[model samples]
Target: MVVTVGLARLCRSVGRTASSLSVPHQAAAAGLPARTRFISTTPASNLQFKLDERTAHSSLDLFKKNTGIIYRMLGLDPSHVQNNPERFRDWAVVLGDERISGGRHYWEVTVKKSQEFRLGVADAQMSRHDCVGTCNTSWVFGYAQRKWFAMTNNKMVPVTLVGRPERVGLLLDYDAGLLSLVDIEKRQIAHAVKAQFKAPLCPAFGLWDGELLTHSGLEEPEGLK
Candidate 1:
């Protein structure tokens, strides 16, 4: 079931900006404000790309390994956004650093639906929590028998494979700037870290061994194994 609600009530400013790529003017007219504009991460940053030579018989051969997705932002196209309902800027998905994917989707989404999308697993469970999307902060949402959460602000948000643990969640105490790894069975913080972002940053995580891995810092890998 698709629950269609009007755009959010919280409003911000819409700065004069333009998308790098040329999209039709009315593609995305967000109702968000300019000042509220935030990009989770810049796509230009040097993220690791593992190319394996093993697939080929020659060592010179390389293949893409690590499955890390990057998020970023840019201005909007006048024509594409001309018919937009939003008075502010809406988030656009830019993949390969140059091409515009048009919209967002999660990894957990059907393989067909998320094939070229730039979004991550949905935090639908987090809708119940109260969050002020301004300052960079992270929030936790319960998933499965364990608890999982996503930390996001206005900018780009990126999620990666975290651990092999059957149950896991990414959670944070925004006010405290405290990020935690929760053990649902024990109901405690298995691991934790302090955020060091002057501006808002969005960070999502996945399971590894039984450990929590994030941009904040890495804990020893000892997952639910």
Candidate 2:
């Protein structure tokens, strides 16, 4: 099913604050940093997919062992994370159950209120201890410190947008070796990367604060079609 959704405008500025690597309470106690918090209303047409069972089970087990990692829905919710007094592990990530090895797939992420987050794709065998953009198996567009960046294999390239976009569109053309980040509000491409992707790549997400609502099964934007 294909659905069209409206992208909302950013409501308020959360100020330029550095996000903490630890969970909220620990960050407060350690004087790490503050983050903006907001509630997200899921779109009626929002696409839903099963969580990667293996990864989810392992993450839950790790949480029981006090690993300081937590996955909620499509992204991390640091506010609900607990147990570790140290910084959150770079592996605090999640992958969608579906894998893409062919064809072009598109999805939209509502992130205007998220203080810090990463959206992208990763190999099915990606290391659980590594951040999404820190390994060759993954490619990500991240927002942190009020800046946007595209990253892979530990290399980050700054992405400058005209303004903050309330919704970001990701288009992955697997056969073409292309991944593009679109600024939905501006109806323009924010960044694009080309790579010989390995088959069965999974949609990946890493969130430090706020929430992300994903709308999938979307028709390609008119300009791109």
Candidate 3:
């Protein structure tokens, strides 16, 4: 299912303060590459996949590390304000607003700060079978299908594919990192946009004043800053 809100809206929905946004946290992986984060009620990591059987990518294993997963932010609707530090990542902050050319809504979310945090799926045992994801709380944009899919980080994960809400496209999603198109009828993915840059801290994408605004999260226009 398509998220009710866009990625921008997703960010703003998690209301954040300037302080929270500016927290100094290292984004380094210490030699391990980030798997994938499925934006949902909970996040899941696909570290369970195996090129071979001896080792695996277990979503539960990542959460077990505790160093990467924060359990306090589960199942909370963003936009709820809290007078606490723990709520920083749990809430969605409004970022910008505009009556764009084709958007259904004029609001956007400014994620206060996200430092590669991960959330585990409900039943961690089954979900980490593939080398796909571990964080069930993060959002995903399928490059090949031009659509978005929502999945919580659990062994028996909850995934919503736009147009085809019932089918579980787990194997297909494993390769969704650069996805751009979603084939609902076939329950699969297709097409991909080529890119050359590492992801920015925050990347801006939307329609504004009849122009499609696209830029890095740090490069948000002066007005947004």
1-225 per-residue lDDT for model 1 (tens digits): 111112242212222221111111121012322223232233332222121111111111111232222222222353444342221123221111111111111111111111112111112111212222211232222122232222234222222223224444333333334444444455444444344323332332221112211121222223421
Instruction: State the lDDT of candidate 2 residue by residue for 4-120, as single tens digits.
Output: 111131111112221111010111022323223211222323333433434432222223222222434344354545533223244446666566666777788776356667788
Q: How far off is residue 168 in model 3, in Å?
A: 4.4
Which residue window of length 10 is worst by lDDT in model 1? 20-29
lDDT of 2: 0.56
- Give me the overall lDDT of model 3: 0.20
The lDDT for every candidate, in the order shown, is: 0.24, 0.56, 0.20
lDDT of 3 by residue, 136-177 (tens): 222222211222333222111122333422221211121222
Report the candidate with higher lDDT, 1 versus 2. 2
Better of 2 and 3 by lDDT: 2
**Which 10 successive residues of model 3 have the least lDDT summed?**
19-28
In model 2, pairs of residues that clash are: none
Clashes of each: 47, 0, 58
